[model samples]
Target: MAMAAPAMRMASSASFLPRLLPPTVFSTARAQFLVRQLSLPLFPNFNIAIPVGISLGLPSLPEVLEGIWEGILKAVPKKKTSHMKKRHRQMAGKALKDVTALCVCPACGGMKRMHYVCPTCASTHPADIFSLAPTPSTLISSSGSSSLRIHDTTSPTYPLAQTITNAHKLGCHHLATARGPQTGNIFASVGFGGDVKIWRQNPDSKEYELQWDLPTVSDAGKGDVWAIALSADENFLACTTSDGRIHVWDLAAKEKIQTYETGGGRGAAGGGGSFAMAVDLSRDGRLTASGHENGGVYVFNNDAGRMVYSLSGLAKPVRAVAFSPGCKRLAAAGNAGIIALYDMEHGEHVGNLSAPGNRPSWITSLDWNDTGDYLLSGQLDGKVKVWDVARGACVATHSETDSALWCVRWLPPTERALGPGMGKGERFCAAGASRSLSFYREATGI
Candidate 1:
């Protein structure tokens, strides 16, 4: 009995020894494995930030080795995880863009993701775009569901304050908002169904109330309204039709005032007629310019009711046209991937503004700042450029997206402030084939 007890005690002791030995072996193996993993990649040269895993492991090294490293190099205190979130919030606050969201595409029935084209519909028009009124508080935009929307920019997130649905039976194509305190809130929009509607914000209701709607064509055929423009005082509304005819309407009397033709009522597709691809009203309300699919540009005098200038310059379809805030110069861009600036007073062509190493991508849009000092341009290749008009050079370049740009505009400086730093609050909106609106602000220019 005594021998058996001793043997049992020996067996129990032997089993305890095996358990202790395994723990030591297992710990060694784990330590070796972790060291190998750390040695594999010290750090990646990621531009924005470091990976999270490496940041955590950096503090767990042995203290003895830390002293040896401290003598050879200085160590920066590791960044706290909470600090990352705080820094990001700071950046977003200073960003020129505040609110960005996609407008659901009526054609494709989907959202336009960044850079990627629409997956469902083949149409290329931007989903929703806000045409900021010359005034600071008002904005107008087009939607995919045959609707036109207007927003109040005073809100921090720029919420949609009004929506005009069924404005166009087919769909609304473009929107234009007038400048000035009194005229700023009043705007006009044209739809695919050949109708132009005018909206005014009712002071009593604080809502956009439909003041007038003009049916451009007799029959609501497929060939409908193509483009629209509103004069500075919001008195005269100019609209172009698919039949290549320009119709001018007087809002004060609610009557068709005049009609201008482009010689032939034939447009690009021969649907109704191609009168104009794009149009714009001069800041002074004296001159009106129209771009045609055949790459023709014409400026007419509203008072004279006659074509004053048949500009001979660009040969490709013109997509965008703008008059400098001063009304001295006209800038136009289109499929040729070039912007042609015209001296309206002299009735002569000014020099073209294009970069020397510039690629031959389609120049889809052009906009001049209020002072006419800088011009903002967007292209089909997803490049945004700010041009110095006096120097005739590109001062800054911003790449927003690759989709074709439909429109670009400089947010006018506010009444409270003007100059470089005053624009800290200035933001511009861009919309195009991407079915979304993008906001950008000038990075602090030293």
Candidate 2:
């Protein structure tokens, strides 16, 4: 009994012992017949916080459903709408572009609002237009459906004068015209199949015909002729290759005259070069520039037959490159979506042009006006923006379709009777995945 009393006192003073043994029945019964008092819920509220994934594996579906239903109870729709929701709904309703009210202008026969200036000439087409070139009197456009169409921009109807069917069996990717020997009769086009064919405009009938094709260089790889740039004299044609070599062809001789290497070509992939994406010839014919898949921008002193600058601002593949009419500035764009401008004199990254709020869509084409005051850029999002070089701001933006825009070109400067209702001096042409040619004029730029 003394020993039992001592043990009971120790148990009351210490923590629970895992090896507790019950006393004999006689000793326990003789001691007391007291009943053990059961403990009710300590918190009464069983809303205990349980961590996620307490189960060794996945929980049952019914339990998951119960948790989901509990979450739903907390997210029940408000009986009274909040002001922020009302404001958002109102803004959304107003944000949609209202094109249902467009009607063709009687004077110019272009779609416009009831009483506003006719905005643009929306020409309907069948297949995606991939390239466009502007001659003195006509606009030539190409599409994937194996036809190149010529439009007479001088006329009120902009009538199609000719359609050369099956010009490219696999479709053309690029077309380039010389700057100013201004023959207005010669142009070059590069196809996806890697063939470079020259076209000549017949003065008599004003129809174009396949003039000549440059033979592939002895070591040129498959699908090598990707971009073409014609010089001002219309004598030398510069092009980029799949193997990263820039080849300049003498049109008069129909032979490749000079080859500049940035690696690639002869056993290049093992340790030599990358694909060249774009090429451009300066108006003066003194400089030639090319952009490559390695994000290299190389400006070659054509006379020196060597590279001058390998620019480095953009780390993404270069897609489009252009030299200003004066050849003082060069612009390049690519997967980075920003246009990097380089000073030709110093070969320094002078400035960058990008969209205001968001990154621009991949820039597919770039052009500068004759005076070098405005820069035209075409984007994959089917938008064409005209940027003012001096101001560094977007002067205008036009969206014609949801499809990607492949090319945009400024028409040769001309004096024409302004459309009766509008007042823009500049005319530009754009073609893209929609297979249509969209012409835009500066509502008041003349």
Candidate 3:
């Protein structure tokens, strides 16, 4: 009776305990099996059967609980995450994205992404074209070096056609070439050694030969010759002097023709020292213009053999002066960065083109395209800007290098096909301290 009572009580206790658990994990079948196992004898009698896990000495209930408690202890938090560590995790997804930048090329009229070159044209130069002169087949470039490199303008590659070794004994700083309808195959180079020498292509050898030299003692001495220009006929040469005198020589006769003096030249007492730095003869061989260190620009009439217009408004050293193809307008700029436009007919200050509210480096060189439509200016910041004459607006800007650009010039118009969608617009070249020549084609080209 006592055994029956204890078994009945144990059975009641087991049944009641199962009711306390949720039914999902421990179903009715599982509760019944667990109760059957719990009702078994604590120890085995003789030859009694035991479950395989118990006979194999599997872990006891208390030992299993102790292992679980140890696992929980191992999972405890170690340390707080740092702010920087959290930030890195947060930014991981947002950091993976492409940055697309775009730029419209001034020369090719092609739209391209920034930080890339034009896909159509491949132009390069060995040295800066300190003074660029157009020729029949290529461009003659002179830098601070003695070698004069001729670049083929017809091909997009701008291959080097000829190199005049030791063209200037002391390194040529300026080069001038003219092969227009009125001019023959003649070019001029002025060197730092203080001498001027004219060259012509030898018909038989197809190489340039020294044709003439200027008298000097010293060429780089008092009233030193600073800049030179040649007329379309190649018969007249104009050069600037430190004393602010522009001397014209008849190249054919090798005689001094006329000298245009700025009233502010060193010859005048209390007159601001005039240092003529740049000179250019009109394409028609009618006018001569010179820029001076005294911020003065002078236009001289070739036929009249006198000064015509003395332009102002620069108030700073004028580094570059250029005339329009039609000989009607003149463009001048220099240390002031503001490009001053003047009328050759009325000799009046017509307009000015400048970037407002921005710090500008010195304007080193200027060239007017053959069409007289766009004016290209290269600055010390290694940036080239194309200014529209009609609208007086900066149309395109190329910022390729951070070095100073010494010169820039427009290439002659050509109908030759370079590549698809290329060769339709005006093209120009720029060179400077970077020692690499860069050519940009106007998107207007075919």
Candidate 4:
């Protein structure tokens, strides 16, 4: 009985205990069968790579390296920027020194900007240094060293405040300034080396600093360039070559706009024989006046892009031709030393601005003041004489230089003077071969 009771208790305890789990339950007999079926005994006994070759493809070492390099390169990131900063230093109201220009004379030390004052001696006496321009301040002069000078007209001693050097290699022979109600202060210069330099002032400042530079269209050389002129609005620049070619450049668009042949065979004729000598743009930018060595003056119409008039009055080599402020009259002069005023409206030789006693002695330079009331002529004998056009009289004769005067210009009246209720008249500037520039204004206060 005792054995039976213990057996029953053991059976009950076994029933209450949990069943034990097997460690290899996942290793089924079917899985083992599948693995054995997939096994390849030949490849396993030989090389594993043989089966890899059959399964995939073969590749050379170089090809593998190249592919690896391309993959690495593709995984790299690209840089988005450089080291340059966005902001820069500003130029304040600090006065710039070295603003003065020095002109050397044969006997004396350096001359001031006007060449009218001796800074070393503080002398005011005139030394007959050079014939001053009609209104000197606005007159900008250039030299062989490639520097441009602008003088102030308001002061009796016109002082230079700015200098733009390296304007061109060789030297500058011709320069022109634009005068318009909107764009009055811009100017241009041409060098013997066939390069043209255009200059403009900063609109925000009155300092008149260098603003931009234009590239040369022709190869750099002396004979390739002869003269340069700017339109009244400064939108165009016209340059003449010794080969008798005229190239018109669009300054605003910075491109070559037009070209015209002056008639030439290179080296066939003398310097002026085959090429154009001088070119001038009228006030309205509608007409272009060109003076040739053969004493031919042709007026080109900008709108028509054709020669409208060929003047026949002057037979002497026409050196300089200028249109009046109104563009109604044209003044042509040169080796003849005579100012022939023409009427563009009627295409007639209206009158002459030459004085009664003035002889034919190379009238190298001519300019009409802003008012068009006076005419300025510079002679090879270094005489700058202003003529009254209305009366055809020589109003003022200033012979300050014996050196040939190369260029002459009238400074436009200041805004204050040009404003309403102001009566300030007459101002101009003249530059010569003597390496000096002079400025002059009608002695309104003196």
Candidate 5:
């Protein structure tokens, strides 16, 4: 009876145990308890006792294990994320805002998006740049605009140093600077309005000012002047006319000293000779060369005052002509897309620089580096090429833009005014239909 009484009490006290065990376990225990009660006679030795002061609010095993797993997870270190990755993730769902508003370009009257470069207007000029001339410290650019802009090339930015507004009312087409030691102080420009203006740099202030303009009486002999070149000493100037006449001016006397006629009196009867599209004066002032629209390249003896050589080989219009610094070779290129090299002394077609393809882009401009070992050319298809004059091969080519390139020139090798020493190798600048100027430097292995 005592055992039976304790067993009854233990069974009643077990009501609080359901909190510790799951419902399924509690139900199974209850079923086992009923079976033991019914079989008490078979298990009379079994004893039941209620544990005193036991807590009933303890967690189940599964919940205790789950809490342990959570602690382990909290203690584990997290992977680090880079700032770039975080930025990409944060911007993943965002879209770029579009600029929809348009405005008129003040310079060219062309429409463009606000705060954007005008498609019709060139970098700083309202029209296409026609010529580029480099001094030791500055780069002079003449566009179809009335303004002539000078940029400081010593600095990497090539900042605009000065702007001569309305220098050419009808817009200038060609600019010429002396190539030797006496350069930078004096330069010349020919405008579309048939006027050639001389500009001289101030020795102290370093600012350029108008020296003089060509007299109108000179134009009576020949039509509009199209191109001009300066003598190495800056003492003389050579200009070409639309009627195939090459005129030399003594700048000091401000008088037309000599005139070489390529038109052979045909221009007087209104039948102009093939228009003189390009002209150059040899550095020694011994030779004057002109390239005409009819692919005739003529080299005149400046000392003898007559034509020396009538060069041939190119069948298309000649647009650009340049004499080597040593006066040994002359390079001429134009619509034919081939550069013709001529021996200046013998007036022989020495070689040609051309690509192997059937169709080639027209070469518009050409310049020789100071050493005369390399030649640079700009093409109508927006390509700039550097040629090894000795090897007769194109060494490098750059096609930064697909717009027509009108002018390209090599900056004279000089100590950078902003730096410690002279530039390592050759450097050049190009400008054209993009309305912007691009500068390139030779790649060095150092």
Candidate 6:
């Protein structure tokens, strides 16, 4: 009986053998076999019975291994990535494009990225463009470089029609062309060195040639000339000087014909009069108007050979002045950023044209359309505005750059207008510190 007791203990201890072995290496069948082998050897007379099925109070090897694999799978993602999530991950850390980084193309009249070479047109001057003048069929541009460039306005590409190399040794600042018929054959340019050169188009070849240069010594008080204007007949040239004197020269005789002084006898050494910044002649060749640095506008009767009116109202330096085609109204603007309209007949302050803003940009240049219905103005803030003269309101505004605008001009109407608003044939060009000329056409629904 004592031997049988030891066998019972052995069998009871065998039940825990499965728990001691690794779950992968242990099984229910192996547990039963071990118990039987140990019990039968200890007591042959005792009836040793081993259960076919045994419970170790734990999961089996196969069941435990499967449960462990399922837990590992739950730790990882199961669903496929969505399209939206994948796109977001791909686009992360990228910057959005700016909406205002665009401008109007000068050639094709389309939109393009600002400061980038336009795909439609890739034309530019080597240096800053300071002045722009338009003839009936050509557009002339002068820059800080010593060359004068002429572009064919009649062509879409604005192809370079002519290039006058070494036209000015010290760069050109101002250029003037006749505004009416019988004057397209001649033009004038003022250089930084204070010399005025006249160019005449050849009658047979249709090319411009340097006709003559005004001797600097012949100027009033030996002062430098700044602005110039030509008469409709192309027979007379009027120019402003640093000594606050306006001189009229007869081109046919090649001599100074008339001298109108604004300095009131204050010699050139006595701080002369305020510098005359701009000048223009009436279409009929009857009136001459000049704008000065002291914000003074003066009108003279060329026939009477005397000062007609000393205009007022502008408090800042005057930079530009123009007479309406009809010769009834005069428009002037300057650092004040406002356009003052004066009645030419009575020399009375009529009205003002200004945009809505607290600090408006300095007006650099002004021009009237052929019909005198609209006025075109270029500003230092890189803005060009068209004001309706009748309504005294700005009709259109264009901002294609952030650089200063030095000059703007309305291109003469062509026989066959091509772009939008062709029925009206209204087109204009602007140039400035950008060193490129930008052309814009009136927008129309068509």
User: How would you encode candidate 1's per-residue C-alpha lDDT over 108-191 as one tens digit per residue?
Assistant: 456754323244533323354423343467456675557665655554334456666666676666778775556676777766
Q: Compared with the true structure, what per-residue lDDT tens digits does model 3 show for residues 42-123?
A: 3122122333333221234454577589889989989998988777976896344444566665556777544334444433
Name the lDDT of candidate 4: 0.64
Tell me how far the alpha carbon of residue 200 in candidate 5 is from the true structure, in angstroms, after superposition. Answer: 0.9
Q: Give lDDT: candidate 4, residue 331.
A: 88
What's each prediction's clash count? 10, 6, 10, 13, 2, 0
- lDDT, candidate 5, 380-413, per-residue tens: 9999999999999999998877799999999887
Global lDDT scores for all candidate models = 0.67, 0.75, 0.76, 0.64, 0.82, 0.84
Candidate number of the best lDDT: 6
315-434: candidate 2 lDDT, tens digit per residue: 888889999999999999988999999999999998999987676689989988888999999999989999998888888898867789989898777676645555547778887886
Candidate 4 wrong stretches, greater than 4 Å:
1-138, 204-223, 264-273, 356-359, 415-423, 444-446
Q: TM-scores of the models, in the given order?
A: 0.66, 0.73, 0.70, 0.64, 0.70, 0.73
**RMSD score of candidate 3 (Å):** 15.1
Between candidates 1 and 3, the lDDT winner: 3
Estimate candidate 2's alpha-carbon lDDT, on a 0 to 1 scale.
0.75
Cα error, residue 67 of model 3, in Å, equals 51
| Ranking 3 against 5 by TM-score, winner | 5
Error of 2 at 383 (Å): 1.8
Q: Looking at candidate 6, what is the lDDT of residue 182?
A: 45
Q: In model 6, which runs have C-alpha deviations exceeding 4 angstroms? A: 1-123, 264-271, 419-424
Q: Report the Cα RMSD per candidate.
A: 16.5, 14.0, 15.1, 24.1, 17.6, 15.0
